[model samples]
Target chain A: MNRQHIWAVLLRNLYLVRRSQYRAFSLFYWATVELFLWGFVTLWLQDISTPDVKITLVATVIGALVFWDLFFRVQQSLTLAFLEDVWSRNMLNVFASPLRPRELVAGYILLSLLFGFISFVFVLVLAFFLYALHIWSLGYYILPFVVNLLFFGWALGFVILGFTIRYGPSVEILAWSLPVLVQPLSAVFYPVSILPPLLQKAAFFIPTMHLFEGMRAVVLEGRFDVGHVVWASLLNVAYFALAIVFFYWMLSLARRRGLLSRLVMD
Target chain B: MQESRLPGSVGIPPILKVTDLAKSYKHLTVVDRISFQVEEGEVVGLLGPNGAGKTTTIHMLLSLVKPSGGSIQIFGQELAKDREGILARMNFAAGYAALPYNLSVYENLNIFSLLYGIPDRRAKIEQLLQEFQLTRFRKQRTGALSSGEQTRVGLAKAFLNDPKLLLLDEPTASLDPSIARDLRALVRNKMRAVQGAILWTSHNMQEIERVCDRIIILKQGRIVAQGTLEQLRRQFEQDDLEEIFVALMALPEPAMEQTERPR
Candidate 1:
């Protein structure tokens, strides 16, 4: 992929982010609101906890909140970035340049990292100052778990982008809802034990299941489940590979079908 | 960026060369067995009615559409193998495709310049901003611009690289007369200065006649006739290129005309 091309994509997208108040507001607002909603609830749960409850009540809620937003931040990073191109009708312009298909992906991947990190900083600071909660309080080793969730978000993002490109805007509703559809299976909030046994079986294929399960272990039981971490990492790589391959396929399909011109929004 | 040139050390090859170019969907052909060439500094007009496969032909040349059967060689390099190299020296604009709505005109041009790896991006952008009279509107969102202003911006973006081959699809549709005249002059002057070849598509017969050195008229996915304005006028016994175009559209080809949707 061309670095200059990648930089061009990034530069334009960031310009959109900087210029549009609505876009910038949407990026920062959701995480802050999610933090507040869960932050107060965690405080309420801490008040009513009994001795057998055993878990650090606030940490579980706060960790789940922070990491869920990380997953969400990257998801929006990838999905919204693709939508920016679609909505602006800018895909044809970019494709006409020397930028390759993979360069588009590379550029958005960089934006995902950039936005994901910024969201992380904002949410982390809010959680710390408001609830006196720290992700560090869980342990520095949770970094891998965070990375796994972010990759999973990126994977889901590619799937959404693929569907949008191949099917056109008629099915772009899939882009917004697909990630949330996986959330129930992901077990982002409650334990995997809370899931029905059949869903438990399906959850094994979902890497975030392993992550939330592993996060509970670290935060509540004071143990790092290397097995879950390893499983999540391997699945992250596998899913990410498949999604990217599928995305490239969809792009060529869009071109061959003469559908790129009509791949616009209403 | 410095242009990535073909191996034209001794003599310049045709700027664009297409051999047996055709496109089809299943059994339905959209563009059929059309061949053409454009030389250095020549502006060729691609004139055709709606559904005549003019857009499809342009898309194939840009590698945006897959032709059912054909070969395209731009600057003596095969398009399939040298797409990046060829596209780097080429740029296109259509009234249909859009710039980012949220980006300012300056940001949009800057992004494209960086993508093309232009050697002096700032100077290039500043020059275009002045030429398009977009300097004052540099900070305005592109979507907020008036239609005529947007057309100007589109043209400005297209000319950013001073490409050797430029493809314009209804490029001046929304421009005022003065702006349109200036843009036509720009295309005219670029060819003299850089030997740039433009494959321009416009419904305005007057505009095409003014700018194009040679004309290729298509009807129902096939090139019905092609020549200089004088040559075509002489052949069709018509007084003007517009009349020649009207006469060509009157030909019988209902089978090719309506069987498939314009791609």
Candidate 2:
């Protein structure tokens, strides 16, 4: 691959994300809604907790919400990409170019990350003002948060995008349903510890539990949850690897069955 | 000027060459052992019916779909090995594909221009906008453009990098007759000054006759006939290109055109 060419593809896609009204509004809404909800919770719930506990709890909620949005954003991007292309028959046009499937996947993932970052930062800033809480761990946790969120989203994105490519019209409902199942089990609103023993074991397998737990540790306790963060990151990487395999498998299967052409067929 | 001369000054080689190309899906063969050459400054039209595998052949050539077996040399290099190098000097335009609809026309062109890494993109984009009459709609979202206008934008984008190879699929598909004529004129004028070859696919026999220097008729992914417009006309003994197309498409082939539907 020409590095510059790939960069150009990456940059152009980022610009598209930046230019889209829906994308911009999504980030704004995500941030604003998060601040509104959690900020309201912080004010009303303040008398029940100490200052440090309040900041930590608020940070944890906002952070979880960011990842929650992150999950949905990836699914939306993947499904919508297929839907848009199908609408205009532009997918066929893209497949007609020399652009590799991997490059296209990478571009979509990168765009999703940018959107994720925008939402994360938006909520972070708004929550800071509304809750009057110091997000002290913002300096250290943001990068990891972004990285973990992208790996999870992109990994899931591959599976969703792959399914859409193969069984687009029929399996589209799964696109919406996926986040609902994954996010609730991610232990965003509550600790995994609170779950029943069997469910707690399952939650440990979920990458999101580690992510939320890690954020809580850093922002709430003023210390890194090295074990959980590292484990989550590694698990995420593994998930991403599996997602890639799934995507490639789907592509090959589609090609073999002549369904790959459906990718470009409107 | 004398010092500027270099040894073996052949300039750029032919932009595209295909040798013994063949592709099949499962037991069904789509493109069967076809071969062709495209030099700079040539417009070659690939014509066929719905299921003749015209699109499949183009897909193979562009490396969008991998060929079961064949060799494609683009810009004096094997396309399989040097995709980016070859693609850097190439562009494609078609109605079925477009810039992201959510993006404005300017942003869309900018994204493509950035992909091509064309120097001085602002100036290039301004010129293209003016040339394609898209300047007035630069900020308009692509989804909002009329079919004819969108076709113009697509055509404009194809020429953005001054590519050595331009592949067009129904370049004037939905445009009104007058606008189609204008696009043909634009393409004709642009080709005159550049060392570029255009591989165009279209169902419009009249447009093919008007714009293409050569024609290749594919029946079930195989080239049934290929030559200049006059040659095709004389071979079929038809008065017009459309009649020749009708006659060729009417015949039975390995893959029936009736079974394959057009989008």
True contacts kept of 1: 0.76
Top candidate on DockQ is 1
Query: Taking the tens digit of each residue's C-alpha lDDT, what string does model 2 give over B1-263?
Result: 01111121135566688888888877899888778877777788889888877777776666666787888998888988976667768888877666667667887788677667688999999999999999999999888999898898888888888977888888788999898988887876776557578898999887888777778888878787787777767777998778987887776764344333221
Model 2, residue pairs in steric clash: A92-A264
For each candidate, what TM-score against the reference?
A: 0.93, 0.82
Give the range of the ten consecutive residues with the poorest summed lDDT in model 1 chain A. Answer: A51-60
Give one clash count per candidate, in the order shown.
Answer: 2, 1
- TM-score per model for chain B alone? 0.90, 0.89
Q: List, residue by residue over A76-166, the lDDT tens digit for candidate 1.
A: 8888888888888887887788888888888888899898889888888888788777788658557898789878989999999988887
Off by over 4 Å in 2: A1-20, A38-63, A66-110, A137-146, A168-176, A196-198, A214-226, A245-261, B1-14, B252-263
The recovered share of true contacts, given per candidate in order, is 0.76, 0.35
